[model samples]
Target: MVQSLNSNVCEERVFSNIFQTLSKDVHNFLRYKYGDNLNPKDKVQEAFIKLWDNCKNVSPEKAKSFLFTTANNMMLNEVKHQKVVLKHQQVKPKHYTNETPEFIMEESEYMKKYQRALGNLTEAQREAFLMNRIEGKKHKEIAEELGISRKGVEKRIYGALEKLRKEIDGI
Candidate 1:
């Protein structure tokens, strides 16, 4: 009975080792490609979860291939989602430098009001606004660097603009 138990434990250890080795390779491959787009840690977690769910059917030899395929599909889905979201965001139209403004006074007033409003904002809000507007960072990038949510960055920018508009009206 002791010999039989030892054999069973050895078999289990071998199976566990195989899964671990294959999963590690799969994570490395995905990290090389999509590391910048999605968190590598999250992708690895998802791959392991799938492996766990399908472990009974997945043979040791085929496990690596399965993990790679699953990780690739996940990265593709993330890329497609980001593309759809970015496509919907409206970009400001570019004007030629030679194009003459019909009213310079309005532009000056707007700048003055915007500056005053910016001065009144909280330090975090002002920093976020400047990073987005003056420094030209995407909301996602700003959020990551500032350690804030994307929605928070969006809110700060919108709030800043609204305050500027109100200040202009008061002027």
Candidate 2:
């Protein structure tokens, strides 16, 4: 088949050639700019799909530029969405309960103190205590997981409990 110099890239062979030549370059460009956490491969694939969608308007000479621009724009959109999600996550929503407002306020205040007390505990104590209480693991189970003796786990839990009780009243 004879191809003109200014022919569009709607042909199968032309599109495939463009994908083969530019996919890796576009993928590496995105990965280097934004880590793999942003799914650069997905962006690259989406960009090529977009290029194929608009292939009638994209000439073979312009395919590389179109792929790179489209890929970069897609990644920017994803990064923007991630930032919005993270921003929303940092905000706490109000809760609806049957308890009185005063009781709920006091409960919220106590919860704040409880969290502070948990943070005040030593890292070792906090880890073991959380594994036992929050995760519902037995002392022996926690000891095995943490590579410590059962007695050591018990001591950490005890110390954590003692510190928590002192720091937060009515815990």
Candidate 3:
């Protein structure tokens, strides 16, 4: 038990040292990706927490890069998601104002169809679609999160969009 405790302490020391070194670059990269929308400091804390939780697998030498990659990915995902929600919210109100009752009903029906089409997609396809179309994520970022190649991400997103457009047209 004492030996185990000592090993844990050693891990903590390594994590602390590495976190201190990488926190700045991680913050800067997150800031660049997410802009002023999210707190870079909070992202650093989250990254450190993840590192601490995964300390067993992480070597001291790789800790800095791991922290940077983890934080950047998390922040990018957050930004992409928030932007999608925001875009939907923004679009809904503007189109409502100039329409008649019939037009409003038609628009709502179209939205329902769109939502249904979106729902019918496979999880990966839907995510790729949203990340590419709604969130504007690059193929590389989507690939990183989805654990696929950049080309795969691009193909999935394209395929999803093509299907969605066809479904929408039928409606």
Tell me, by lDDT, which candidate is best.
2
Q: Which stretches of candidate 1 lie over 4 Å from their true place?
A: 1-15, 91-171
Which consecutive 10 residues in model 3 have the weakest lDDT in total? Answer: 1-10
Per-residue lDDT of 17 in model 3 = 62
What's the residue-level lDDT of 14 in candidate 3?
Answer: 55
Clashing pairs in 3: none
lDDT of candidates 1 onward, in order: 0.75, 0.92, 0.79
Error of 3 at 59 (Å): 0.7
Ranking by TM-score: 2, 3, 1
Error of 2 at 20 (Å): 0.6
Encode model 1's per-residue lDDT on 63-143: one tens digit a residue: 667778988898888888888888877565666665357556677877877777789988888898899988999999999
Tens-digit per-residue lDDT, 1-171, candidate 2: 235786668888888878888899999999999989999999999999999999998888788889899999999999999999999999998866679999989989999998999999999999999999999999999999999999999999999999999998886
Full candidate order by lDDT, most accurate first: 2, 3, 1
Q: Model 2 Cα displacement at 111 (Å)?
A: 26
